[model samples]
Target: GLSSCFHRSEGFMRGYPRVRGFYEVLSSCFHRSESPEGLEVYLHALQLLTTIHHGIQTLAVAGGTGQALWTFLCEVVCEDLCQPDDPPFVLQEQKGLLVHALAVLSVLYACQNQEAEHSEADTLLPLVGSMLRVLQYHREVSSGHGQKEKKEEEEEEKVDEQLQALIQTTVEFLSDIITHLTKDAVCELVTRGYLTEKTCLSAVGSLLPQFSPAVQHLVFMLSEADPQLADTVRKEFPVSLSPS
Candidate 1:
């Protein structure tokens, strides 16, 4: 029954032979008359993706299946439903999808074997950038700051907590992946602007308390690659502060 459901639905349209079908479904979800129903169907597909991710270790060894699922999920989230004028869903449902999708991708990246030696940067980096953009858009829409004043104290604190948690999970996952990657790959990610100052700060603040010494050192190296991030750290963590 599960296999039949996946076969009949758009979820099966992920790999090379069915990618066009996958894109068509996504495009239809974006612009068809049955957009809301399409969205629900897409959500169902994502749930199936979660199941596939959970079975990766046992059923799929090379990680290609997981990567394909990740790529499709990213396309649906970042490309289709993530547009400016997209219809609203229940907020909690939307957040659940975003969080789960992100968490699953993190797991896939972390679980790759050492002998694989493949670069997932092409797949993972865009997902991270898109997630950041979604978070930024949500913050903007909810807080109404419009690039003028700094976010209000209450608003900033709330968003900072949510964003920090997401960034922490992502960074922890990436830190694990970084340990397995070549130094040149790590340096390339830094130099190519994939790891921005804001991302570095948020990740460092959240991850420093959890990761081991070696991971922390890697994070520090990545953080130091951005001069603006160093200045931010100095300002936020100044020495000799007066007692409150």
Candidate 2:
């Protein structure tokens, strides 16, 4: 329904006023439908809204709309999209929605972070946790059960285009967040029970040789923020990561 609606309204997202309703519509649809395919349409449309300067500016609405949107999207990503009980194969099944949600959230998270720094801790841990979880699943499915390939092109052939984009976006966003962690921020994540050995292991599994530099940097940060956590991560893969 929305796919057709979006196609019919060719220039609906031109002005700021026209784009403001998109978030409200997305929130309403997700609550009503709760279907993966339906949510995909909403996230895709929402992603498009963030592509323009005018739309992004409108999305940066202060206490009125943008704040609500930022909060809603965090829940959408961390809780609604993929659940802990779901298996790794779900990542492949929901590639399109994952790509759309993550891409748009990255944009909105940046906007919200700039708008108000207070909620960073509130949202950052769960948001990064979800991104890492998705990435770990991507790695699990993409590996094709011990069918690893050395050549980049050969590896590329195993995953479809949408999934390739999902993996790339996940790594990029995770890197942006991980590489900039303050010692205090890392401490907060640890104290709040978000940064633990299991989380570190997932981080290692996804990052490893693909994101060696980032993993290495994260290790350095952890060493300063909390040595026990850093040691746990380091022991998991001693050879793969060296201090930066």
* TM per prediction: 0.52, 0.74
Local accuracy of candidate 2 as per-residue lDDT tens digits, 1-244 = 5445444443654523455476777777788754667777778877776776656777776665667676777788778666666677777666787788788867866776552642476776777777777776776666574233344786456656777788788877787677667778778777866677766677676666777777887888788888887888878876333455
Query: For this target, which candidate reaches the highest lDDT against the unseen true structure?
Result: 2
lDDT of each: 0.50, 0.71
For model 1, state the Cα shift of residue 22 in Å.
10
For model 1, the run of ten residues with the poorest summed lDDT:
235-244
lDDT of 1 at 116: 52
User: Which stretches in model 1 have alpha-carbon errors above 4 Å?
Assistant: 1-54, 57-59, 77-94, 114-118, 130-172, 178-182, 212-215, 223-244
Score candidate 1 by lDDT. Answer: 0.50
Off by over 4 Å in 2: 1-12, 15-17, 115-118, 143-159, 191-193, 201-216, 232-244
